[model samples]
Target: MISAASEVFSHAGKHSQDEIALILQKHLKVDSAGHLSNERRISPTRNQWKYETFSPVWGAPEGLNSKFAPPIDDLKSIRGVRGIPHQSLRSVAQWINSKIIPRCHMEWIVSSGALWIVQLDLEWEETDQGKDPADATMVAEGLRPISTASKIFKAFTPGDRTSWPKLKNLEDFDFGTTRSGPRLYFATAEQLQQALATSGPLLETEIDELTAGRAVLRTDLDRTDSGILNLPRTDTVDGRLAVAWLRDTLPLLSERFGSLSGLAVILHAFLPARAAAWAYFDPGTPIAYVDALWGLPDGLQVLPHDSFQVDIRRGRVISQKIRFKPRFLCEAPDGTWRYTEVLRLKGRSQVLSHEEAIEIGLRTASIAEKLGQDAQIMWFVGIPNAYGVDANLPWYRAREKAQQAPRSARRYRPVPVSKQDDLATLPQGDVMIRLDPEAPLIRDDAFLDEVIRIAQARKLPVELQGSLLSHTYYRLSNGGVPVVLAEPYSKYFRTRGRRVFGKLVRDRVPVGIKAGGEHVSEARLASDDALPGLFAKLVEEGQELLQSSDKDSQVEELSDLLEVVRGLAFQAGAEWEKVNQAADRKRETRGGFQERRVLLETSLPKPQADAQLDPREIKLHEFLRVEETGSFASVPIAALVSKQGYASANFELDGQPLVLTLRLSGSRIELRLEEEPSDETNQGDLFSAA
Candidate 1:
């Protein structure tokens, strides 16, 4: 019996050894002692032991095919095999009756040498007196009205027990057990519809009605008269029975069919022959599906070849094809069959971080910086004008016109132009000049020159002049004219005269014209209304000098007249004439004699005794000596005056000395030589000549 049980265990490909042992112990009564015991008494010790008996003779060739003995009645009734020993055949019979026949198990049917098992479990549900008429109608409709038998039969194949044949009721149905694993109960379409409707509200109510009163029976038991022996039904009496039956029966079937065990349940239905049988079982539930398929009892294994193949493009599964490896299939959260790996692909994920965005911003900033001064202004709709006419032009023109008016009429002068006309007349250009209210009047010559140059380049007319000298006007070739007034000429002449005269006297040079108060007074007298008498006196004096006969006296008077003319020219900012050349020449030609050149004869104040003694000259003298080598010489002196009364230096040297210094002041010198002196005597002779 144990040997037959081992064969059965080996044939049940999916059940673990422990699970098979439990099943055998529960149903076949094959104990660990390798003996078959009846439920009420022990059998006599039967020595049916043979080495070949323990071997799988039902699948082996010689033992069952041997001609030594005819097949025993028990063995024939169990599987119809001719075997060698009666005891051995009886053992096989007990194994078949307890573990194979009643449960519908078979092994090694030999059309060929390949071994295969055909197993089936049948379950019958006894209808109650109050069984819903709706359930009866559902049963009559067929086990799987929506699916073809061939399509539905695959669900009940061995190695899968998580699904089962759904039944509406159990009346006049065979409740026979064979050498199969366990009976499976499945919900009918009506029961499943009710369960689905009760479980989910959003699904259409019609879906609920299609599955009500449907369930599959997973275990075999006698139908007692008492109603307490109730069969499992779908949760909802009206919901779609197919999915609900699958959901409820699959859990129990998977639990009973140990991991990988294979079994099949076939249901009898009133439909046509092609639709009478419905198979139900789960495919092998992966470890992950244990909780979800826990209570299922009739689930058939869905082979890898039976799974649907999906074409994945990009991230989505598009079309399905049969004959691919069975991906773990389970009910999704939405109660639909879904591939677990595909669901994982649909999950949401993030690809960028905040820091990455910040880095992009920094890169943009860097790019903008590299573009440098070439940035262009972006324009938008309806912006106010940035460059407008100078607001101060009206006031400026009014003041200017007022100043131009005669003094008496100026007080009543009106605005030079209306504000609108003033704005309309403003010049337009690419460059805008903003005038500073506190800017000083245009006084710098260079600045004025640039302004004039720019205006000329742009063909804008303008002019330049000192406001105190004279009025100058400029006209553009096109027609615009501007006027500029110089500084007062008289004031410039007086100021220049005072400055030049002061410098000349302070340096002790000869003053050709005086600029003291008396000279100024004389000038004032010449122009003042109160100085007419003085002018007349000066005219009388001039006439007397003109009439004098003594040559010396005449010369003196002529000199005074020459001085007055020079003073006049100097005050007027004109070059002074040493003598009135016109007057002197006239006198010489009229007198028939040449005038003597007095500048050569007159002493020029000894040429300023210390004029050549400049501090820079002394420094030069020291530098030359410091840089001089052997025999190079530097001579220090108090003064060096030129023959023309302009003082500098006279340097004398001999040989190619590095340097020679001629002192012109206590701190000044003049260098003359470049190279070292060969002899001191030669340098001395050069100094003596200087």
Candidate 2:
């Protein structure tokens, strides 16, 4: 619905939220007799339904029950039946905004049934998301729903922390053999002090009685063991995301953090997936409204469940039910509704820990394995949008410090569109932009990283094709075969081919080409140098590498050797199977070098005539300084000198016997054959005695 709306509005030129609201009303709401009136829905361009079968549970009056019943006569009388689709509406509005709005100067939120545009052209503000919505001007004026105008239902904002969804049933967790990992948390000093100040005396005393660093966390539920003892986990999502977004970041932070003064206090919290699902979605009378409001990614929905079963022995959960179950039931890989867990950590001191995160990752991986799908971490509908790195903030600065080079670090120049032909002319490889032209995303970075990772893993040669500033294109190829940049092949390196997406995500950042964006991942590189010679050199190096004690080193080097040989063979017009067959035939007849036998010397009778000499031998010796001192079967002295330059002869120096190698010092002076070529390694045997 949002996509079709965006296409329609964008094509029509400049539009206002008010205009969108009208169009939405026509499309979203049914007519008096429950019929769609939106023309766009039926248009060939969209071809989508504007309305769905009305449900009786929406408290439809008797007059509106039957299919033939008169269209809703009084839109006002049914006004009281409407309420919270809060998050879903926000999600849809955000989607439309992303797809249509180019300028981010204004922020729009759906409230009081009207699109409230908040001007944010100036600077970032300290947003209090939990503030009461009744204070908003639009809500007080009774904007859209008749109930709000008549003061029947209080308008609530989607993320109002106070209005979080309630899960009533609590089941005991049977953590058979599973022990809960460390309970991670995050909070700033101010938030911690505020919580303490608001705590009741008994609860306060309980917290006070705990050891110096411990605290009692109690839920507002009528159950035993609700107050679990936990130490203040002084970690923040800002800290986690800032200091450990990538695996390499932790190593950089662990030992060599240079200056602390540059640190900007980061303000952000992480609610683990289990807890966040509820805050991002609301289950209301009208179910479709939830989808539009949350704009959740496809193949997923939210539900909540118990983290533990009824049996808890000591501290170890001994049963399969010991795992944390979110109250929100999301659609798993197998199309089953399963409880998905999430946690939220906020502020400076309290944050989710690295170990707990690993635990969560493992749990999800196990779930994915059971479902016969790639292991993935599922997220709540709109949660991804809520968390983002603001470069103008301290976290961004920390990010720069953590990285070996900042994201903006220059690597190569961008090939202009005029150089579109240049992409085709690249030495040898496909052309793909390093990343999107706009903001660079971690997921994209991960995607490219995976490219390199797979190539290295497979020992395939990969070249960073070229770059447009920070955006670098990559080409992964082997035997002149480029990667297909699609599924089966595209997902070769990813642990999970799927992704955890944000509400507005289109299949989660769409992992393929953009329209009109030309992409190539393989190329048969052209070179002026002798590729066969290079291949030979690489083979030698690889053989040397094989001499190493480490089998892994040999394997990697051999992979490199194979890549070079493939290119060389292809360039030289050689077939792999034929080469292999030739090798097998030779090995069978002449035998291989399996036995460590040393060839101390090899000898053959010298040929007495040129006719007895092999052409291969002459070609081999053609590279030497020749002094034809002895008569070559009665050749003229002048002619022999002119042709041979110099010749060699056997002689005795003192008691030692030796052949006076063709030394042109005194006999004759001439240049050596410098451009001769030979692939065969032995020519001395070829020349001697035929």
Best by TM-score: 2
Residue-wise C-alpha lDDT for candidate 2, range 182-272, written one tens digit per residue: 1212222233333334643432232222211122121111222322111112221221222222223323323333422111111112221
lDDT of each: 0.27, 0.27
Candidate 1 residue-wise lDDT at 104: 20
TM-score list, all predictions: 0.13, 0.19
RMSD of 2: 30.4
Candidate 1: where is the Cα deviation over 4 Å? Answer: 1-138, 142-204, 210-690
Against the correct fold, how does model 1 do in TM-score?
0.13
Clashes of each: 115, 65
Give a tens-digit lDDT track for model 1, residues 1-690. 878877887887565555544343223221111122111011111121121221221111111211233343442333322333334434443444444322121222211222112233321122212222111121124223232223122233233434322221221121125212112223233333344557544232323222222322232222222221112322212234434455666456446434213333333121111000011111221000000010011111111111111111122212211211212222233333333221111111111122222222232222224433111110011111221111100000000111231111111111121123332343555222111111111222233344434544653333222111111111111123232111112333222223232111111223322321112212233333323433333343455464678999888877755554454555455665544565578777765334321121334566656543322222222222232334542332211221111122233456432444342221233344535443533543454565
Q: Alpha-carbon error at 414 in model 1, in Å?
A: 99
